[model samples]
Target: QQQVKQSPQSLIVQKGGISIINCAYENTAFDYFPWYQQFPGKGPALLIAIRPDVSEKKEGRFTISFNKSAKQFSLHIMDSQPGDSATYFCAASMRGGNTPLVFGKGTRLSVIA
Candidate 1:
């Protein structure tokens, strides 16, 4: 069962444009939200993250905006570049729960010149 749902299974963005991916979760117990970026043949890396207590967080060109009441969150890639192309997965995990991290079905992003 998919606990998290992600939209725009695939996205194409021009270089220097903004690329956005969104996800929604049904589990309120999820307190930690993280966005992971995975390049071909590589493991997913922590791109950026935000907790329910915070509304947003930014790191370099990556940013995560979260809405606790809405049980939704999004990742925004500013000034997207061709090198930024990858498969992104939004995940959540309850700090106290024994469950492993739950992830959305991954979004494939391609940035063109």
Candidate 2:
């Protein structure tokens, strides 16, 4: 079974719009949540992250909203641009452990100029 669930297998957005991606985790022990963005032919890079202790976190145009009680999380892209088009994955892992992160089925976003 997939540990994390994501929606909107694919998405297309106009320039300067908002792009949203959502995810949910099955493991309550997961305290660390991270979002990764990947471009074709390149490794995924960390975009933003949050912990159960926080409700939300934002870095520039990228934002992460975490809900511990709901066991869910989401990524929001503000002022979506063509350059922001990429595959985004929501991941979760336990805090203070060597365990690998569990990633959601990625959401593919395309921004039209």
Candidate 3:
């Protein structure tokens, strides 16, 4: 069962613009939400994350806006640059559940100059 759903399999954004990727989950048990950024031939790395207790979390140019009641969340990349182009995956896990994170299919983002 796919617990998380992500939209826009691919995205193209011009430099200095914003790139948004959305995701939704039905499992209310999820308490931890994280977004991972993966470059070509490299493993996914933790980008930013948010818990149900907060509505948003920002780290530098990356921000995660979450809606706990709606069971949805999104990643917003500000001032998108070509170097930022990568495959982004949204994931969810229950804290201390000992269960691996459930990931979305992924969105390939291409930022043009």
Across residues 1-113, which tens digit of lDDT does each residue of candidate 3 receive?
44899988999999999999999999888898899999999999999989899999999999999998888999999999999999999999986866799999999999999
TM-score rank order: 3, 2, 1
Clashes of 3: 0
lDDT of 2 by residue, 1-113 (tens): 33999988999999999999999988888888889999999998999889899999999988888888888889999999999999998888886877799988899999999
lDDT preference between candidates 2 and 3, better one = 3
Q: What is the TM-score of each candidate against the true structure?
A: 0.94, 0.95, 0.96
Give one digit per residue, the lDDT tens place, for model 1 in 1-113: 34999988999999999999999998888888889999999999988878899999999999999998888999999999999999999999987756578899999999999
Compute the lDDT of residue 88 as modeled in candidate 1. 97
Model with the higher lDDT, candidate 1 or 2? 1
**Candidate 3 ranges with C-alpha deviation above 4 Å:** none
* Residue 22's lDDT in candidate 3: 99
